[model samples]
Target chain A: MSSFLPDILALFFLFSLIIRRLGVNLAFQPATYQLLTYVLLLTIGLKGGQALTSEFTFSLISNSLIVIALGVVLTLVAMLIIHTFSAMNQSDRVTLAAHYGSVSVGTFAVALSYLQLKGVSYEAALNLYVALLELPSILVGLWWLNRNQSSTSLKTIFGHQSLMLLLIGLVIGGLYGDIAEPMVKQLQPLFAVMLALYLIHMGAVAGSKFGEFGSNQLFLICFAIFMPLLAAAIGLGTALLLGLSIGGTTLLMTLAASASYIAVPAVFEQAQPNANVAQALVASLAVTFSFNVIWGIPLYHHIAGVVA
Target chain B: MTLVFSFLTLLMLLAVTLVAQSTGMVVTNYFMLIAALVVYVGWKSRKSVKVSLLKRGRSAA
Candidate 1:
């Protein structure tokens, strides 16, 4: 067993207790939630910027594009599975599909950290791919959900807050990356404060949403846990077929395994308010988030080693 | 307070840019700090909001 496994488990238990004792409402304030989102965005942009500073080769770009394509395909498969097994309404299934399709930045971050700790080298430019893979699944998921429903509109679905912020951030990161020096130096401190503020808010959000988990939510929780594993397995297979390194394979697998809390939930709230945000949030944040962070990262790494 | 948050956010952005330009510290300190702060403030706000809601419910009862 990896040395970090025990630490992850301990952290999970500790966070759960703290969240349960404090209550969810106390953990997830609206302002804090907004701040957390911003922080995540900034982190992603910075990572992309740093990665962009390095040399970009054709092979790296090609591999990234392939990984992204595989991500979308795996997301579709996950959505199909959810649709097949669960009793969720069409809209809910679609929303859930979008989430499964999208990448989880937190999960990706954790995986990146894990790989670095393991002394594994990977293409930092993959961060750009992570950002790229986020949006298409959302569009596809929304399209699938609204296919039969008259209530859905292209404008409303495309013009979501999460989508807009993510796109703007990605664009800025890409543009600024080409510049010789950092263009947003003035805003760095503000972004830092916002990022810290955002994570705390996310903790609160996760805590409050914890209450939303009950017997009624068990099926979805189970689905969330298993579906990622299944998707990761497929992603791993695809990576091997593409001859990606173990580190690259693990990163792709992690991306597949992670679900969207930031982008999907935001879009769902605006597009389908009645789709039970608490249920989605609780399942994604409380159950799956904890599982992936505490156990999945190390577990997947071990598995990838055996396979490789 | 909002001003503080805004000011802090600006400082964070600058710090991140400097760090990014310098060494390859994969972990973004500013982001982690921001996340921690947001969670703390969020928890506090949530508590106050819940208290207000509970008090209103009691009065109605």
Candidate 2:
């Protein structure tokens, strides 16, 4: 319990409320989110790439497929659950399913920090996984939303900043040998600070939607809390099958359970405007984001200890 | 955001699969399981999407 940093997640959330209470959108200026998210993605990629100096392999590719598949399975199941629960209408459920199924990079970052504390050596290649995992859910959602229509558009999917920055990091990291340590030293230290900036911006996003929480259907609140646990269960199974070390298992478990508050929303805006964006946004941002940070991280760690 | 989350999921797949193949750490289970999940889920829910669309149609009309 003491290991948890309630203040970090809470602080950004609080900052959001304060700014909202003051009646200003200070964070949106100069597209701070774009810059900050890319930096976070690039640095994470570089650090991760440095970790994987051995360069490409079948296991890395196949495991990534599995992770992506895991995401798809989760998203599809989450959509089913949301619909079955009558959580919201079709539009909202589809959008929300995408959110639930996708991985939260911020949460992953925090989990990585936690793993470092435990002295766990995580796969640097997982950095690429982090970026790549952002896609399948969005594509799944867009496919659902636009199945009736034509042109879901490959450019729309690949053109995203998150995916691109992540690739650049991986490429740079994969190509460079031994220099990763210095790069990691310079970049990784700033992770906490970068995360703070990202969270503050997210807080503003959450803050923007503060009034929108629990307005019509509040069942997603339950979904939000339950998702991490569900993800952990599946992740634990995956970890066991992968034969990952305890720390690796824990990190994988954490990632599996985590929810996306960043990339999925952008896809919704870009491709599926008719889908209920606000419901999905509020549910993920306000509910899962904080839940994972404050309680879910520790909860998943405990689950990992028990299961892994 | 939900879609973007999935997007992240896909990107990670691209990164890891390439590396794992090189390092000889490529586990076939991941490939088999992901394929199975997709195929199974698609089979089970094949009709659900159409049903929902019909429902939406009824509601909309």
Question: Could you say which candidate leads in DockQ?
Answer: 2
Provide TM-scores for the models.
Answer: 0.67, 0.75
Q: Write the per-residue lDDT of candidate 2 for residues A1-308, one digit (tens) a residue.
A: 43323435445655765786578664655477777777788887887777666755678777888888888888898888677655367878888888888888877877776666556676666677677668888888888877788967787777867777788887788788576668767887787777777777776676677577554433555566556666777877877876666666777777777777667877777887777777777877776776566555554555555556
Model 2 residue runs over 4 Å out of place are A1-30, A55-57, B1-61
Consecutive 10-residue window with the lowest summed lDDT within model 1 chain A = A1-10
TM-score of chain A of each: 0.78, 0.87
**What's model 1's overall lDDT?**
0.63
For model 1, give the interface RMSD.
16.9
Instruction: For residues A1-308, write the lDDT of model 1, one tens digit per residue.
Output: 34323333225434644765565333445665666666656655665655565655677667767767776786688677766666677767677777777878766766765675568976555667677677777767666766777665666656655546655665666566646235455444455454334434455556666667654354565566666677778878876866767787788778777888877787778777777666666777765666576556665665666566
Candidate 2 i-RMS: 13.4
Per-candidate clash tally: 42, 49
